[model samples]
Target chain A: MKTFLFILAGIISGILGGMGMGGGTLLIPMLTIFFTVPQNIAQSINLVAFIPMSIVVTIINIKGKMIEKKGLLKMIIPAIFTAVLASLAVGRTKNAVLQKSYGVFLIVTGVFFIALTTIKLVKKRKAEKENEK
Target chain B: MSKKKETILYIIIGLVAGFVNGIWGGGGGIFVVPLLVYLMKYEERKAHATAIVIILPLCIVSAITYILQGIYNFPLTIKVGLGVVGGGIVGAFLLKKLSNTVLSYIFYTVMVAAGLRILLM
Candidate 1:
C-alpha cells in the first residue's frame, strides 16, 4: 500500500513536473498528509525525485528544440548557488517552523496562480473581441 | 535589451527562483517562466523549456544538500523516480497534443487546493 502510494505520487508529480509547473507543490502535500511522512523528509524526497524526472523531461524538451540556450546559460550558475544555500538553511529549520513556512508558501503561490490565470483569461477574451471587430 | 542588461536580469531571476526551489524542492519554474517572458522577452514556450534546463542544476544542488543532511530517502527516491520517469515520458509527448492553456487551468486549480489544504493543516 505504501509503495503503491509512492508510485502514484511519483507518477502524478512527474506528469506535472514534466509540464514545468512544479510538481513538488502537490507531491509534498500528498506525502505528508497521506503517507504520514514528515514534512522535511517529504520535501527531500520531492527534491531527489525531481533529479531523475527533470533529466528525462529535459532531454525530451531539448530534443523538441524547446530549450533556449541563452536563457539557460544566463540562469544556471547563480541559480545553483542560491539553491544550495537555501537548501542548507532548510536543513536547520525546525519541523514545525518548516511546515508553517511551507503552508504560507503554498497559500501565497496559490493566490498568485489564480491571479495569473485570471489575467490571462481576461487578456485572451480581449484579444478575441478585437479579432471579432 | 542590451546583452549585459539581459544577462544581469536573468541572473537575478535565477537567484530568486533557485532559492524557492531549494527550500521546497519544486516551483522554481513559476518564477523562471514569468521572468523569462516579461523581463527577458522570451516566448512562453521558450521560457518553459529554458526553465526546465535551468532547474536540473538547481534540483541537483539542492538534492545533494538534502542527502548530505541525511534527510533524503534513497530507496523511496529511487522508487518514485522510476514512476516519475515513465509519467514524464508520457507527459512530454502529450505536450504536443494537449492544449497548454487547459493544462495550466488544471495546474492552477491544484495549486490553489493544495495551498488551502496546507494552510489549514
Candidate 2:
C-alpha cells in the first residue's frame, strides 16, 4: 500500500511534468504530506526521478530540432556551478527549515502562475472580441 | 538587448535557476521558460524545449550531490521513477488535446492549496 502511494504520487507529478509544468513542486509536497517523507529525501527523489524523463524528452526535442543552441553554453556553465554549490548547501540545512521555505516557494509559484494565466486569458478574450467585428 | 547585455542576462538567469533547482530539487524549468520567452525573445515552444535541455544537467548534478550526501531511498525512487516516466508519456499526449489555460487554472489552484497546507502544517 505504501509503495503504491509513492508510485501514484510519482505518476501524478510526472503527468504534470510531462506537460512541462513543474512536477517536482507537486511531487515533493505529496511525498512529505501524504507519505511523511523527509524533505531532503523527498527532494533527492525528485531530482533523481526527473533524470530518465528529462533524458527521453530532451532526446526527442533534439531530434525534432526544437532546442535553440544560441547562447546555450553561457546559461549552462553558470547554472552548473551554482547548482553544485546550492546542492551542497541544502545538504547542511535543517529539514524543517527547508520544508517551510519550500512552502513559501510553492505559494509564490502558485500566485505567479495564477497572475500569468489571468493576463493571458484576458488578452485572449480581447483578441476574440476584436476578431468578431 | 545588446549582445553583452544578453550574455549577462543568460548567465544571471542560469545562476538563479540553478540555485532554485538545487535547493528545492526542482522548478528551475518553470523559472527558465518565461525568461527565455519574454526576455530572451525565444518563441514559446523553443523556450520550453530549451528550458528542458538546461534543466537536465542541473538535475543530474543535484541528484549526484544528494546521493553523495546519503539522502537517497533506492527502492522508493525506483518505483516512483518508473511511474513518473509512464505518466509523463500520458501527459505529453494530453498536452496536445487539452486547453492549456484551463489546465493552468487547475494546476495553479492545486499548487496554492497544497502550499497553504504545507505552510500551515
Candidate 3:
C-alpha cells in the first residue's frame, strides 16, 4: 500500500512535472495536506527527488537532441550561489510560514501563467482572423 | 544560444527566482523549472534539478546583493529542504506504477487546479 501510494505520487509528479506544471507545487501540497508529512521533510524530499528525476530528464533531452548546453552553462554559477546562500538563510523559519509562502507562490504563479497564456491565445486567434481576412 | 542571449536569460531568471526564493523558501524550481523544460528544451527531470542547481548560485548572487541590508533564515531552510527531499522520494517511487491514462489525468488536474488556484486568488 505504501509502495502503491509512492507510485501514484511519483508517476503523477513525473508526468505533470514533465508537462511543465511545476513538480513542487503538487508534491508539497500532497505531502502536507494528504500524507501529513512535515513540511520540512516534504520540501527536502522534493530537492532530493529532483536529483534523480533531473538525471533522467537530462538523459532523455540529450538523446532527443534538445538540451541547450550553452544556456545551462550561463545559468549555473549565479544560480548555485543563490541556492547555497538562500539555504543558509532560511534554515530556521516556522513550517506554516514556509508552506504558506510556497502555497502563495504556487497560487500566484499558476494564475499569472494561466492569464498570460489566455491573453497570448486570444492575440494568436485575433492574428489568425486578420490573416484569414 | 549565443553567449549574450544565454547570459541575459540566465541573469533574468536567476534574479527573479532568487528574489522569490530568498524571500520565500520556494526557490527557482517553481518558475524556472517549467521555463527551462518547455521553452529552453530541458528535459523535465533536468529542468527540475537544474532549477535548484541554478538557483543555488543565483540565490548566492542575490544574497550577496542583500547582505549589506539583511540576512536569511538558514535553519528553516534546512528543515524545508528535508521535507522537500523526503516527499520527493516517496513521490518518485509511487510514480512508476500508475497507468498513463490515470497519470495524465492527474497531471492535467494538477495543472488546472494550479491555474485555477492562481486565477481565483
Candidate 4:
C-alpha cells in the first residue's frame, strides 16, 4: 500500500511539477504520511525522489524544445542559492515534526498558490474585458 | 543586460531555496519555476529546465554537507535515488504529450485543493 502511495506521490509530484507548481508540496507529505518514514529521512527521500523527476522533466522538455537557454542562464544562480540552504535545514528536522511540517507547509503553499493564481486570473479577466472594449 | 539584477535575484532565490531545501527537500524546482516564469519572464519549459540545472549543484552541495555533518544516510538515499531516477524518466516521456496550460490548471487546482485539505484536515 505504501509502495502504491509512493508511486501515487511520485505521479502527483511529477504532474504538478511539470505544470510549474512546486512539486515538493505533493511529495513531502506523501513521503511522511504514506510511508510512515522518518522526517529527516523523508525529506532526503523527497529530494532523492524529486531529483530523477526533475532531470527527466528537464531532458524531455529539452528534447521537446521546451528549454529556454537564455532564461536558464539568468535563473540558475538564485535558484541554487536557496536550494542549498533549504537542503541543509531539511537535515536537522525530526521525523514527527517533519511530518507535521510537511502537512503545514503543504497547506500554506497550496493556499498561497491558489490565492495568487486567483488574483492573476482576476486581473487577466479584467484586462481582457478592457481590451475587448 | 541587467547583470546586477539577475545576479541579485539569483542569490536571493538561491539562498531562500537552499535554506528551504535543507529542511523541505524539494522546491528548487517549485519556487524557481515561478521565479523564472513569473518574475524573469521565462517560458514554462525554460523555467523548469533551469530548475534542473539549479538543483544539480545544490544536490551535490547538500549531499556533501549532510555527509560532513554525519547526518547523511547513503544506503537509504541510494534506494530512494534509484526510484527518483526511474520517476524522472517517466516524467520526461510524459512531458511530450502533455500541455503546460492544461497541466498548470491541474497543478494549480491540486495545490489549491491540497491547501484546503490541509486546513480542514
Candidate DockQ values, in order, are 0.73, 0.85, 0.15, 0.41
Give the Cα error of residue A125 in candidate 3, in Å. 2.1
What's the fnat for candidate 2, on a 0 to 1 scale? 0.80
Candidate of highest TM-score: 2
Q: Write the per-residue lDDT of candidate 3 for residues B9-92, one digit (tens) a residue.
A: 777776566556554434366778667765677776566546644544443444443333334334433444443444544444
Full-model lDDT, candidate 4 = 0.61
Best by DockQ: 2
lDDT of 4 by residue, B34-77 (tens): 77767778876676676676776666566555555565456655
Q: What TM-score would chain A of each candidate receive against the reference chain A?
A: 0.93, 0.96, 0.87, 0.71
Q: Per candidate, chain B TM-score?
A: 0.92, 0.97, 0.54, 0.74
Q: Which is the better candidate, 3 or 4, if ranked by lDDT?
A: 4
Candidate 4 Cα RMSD (Å)? 4.1
Pairs with steric clashes in candidate 2: none
How do the residues A1-133 of candidate 2 rate in per-residue lDDT, one tens digit apiece? 8888888899999999888888888999999998898999999999999999988888877998989999799999999999999999998999999999999998999999899889878999999999999
Docking class of 1: medium
Per-residue lDDT of model 4, residues A1-133, tens digit only? 6455556566666555554456655665555545656666656656655655666666666677766665444445555555555555656656556555666666566566667667767898899999999
For B47-73, candidate 1 gives per-residue lDDT tens digits of: 888887888888888888988998877
Candidate 1 residue B35 C-alpha distance from true site, Å: 1.0
Per-prediction tally of clashes? 0, 0, 61, 29
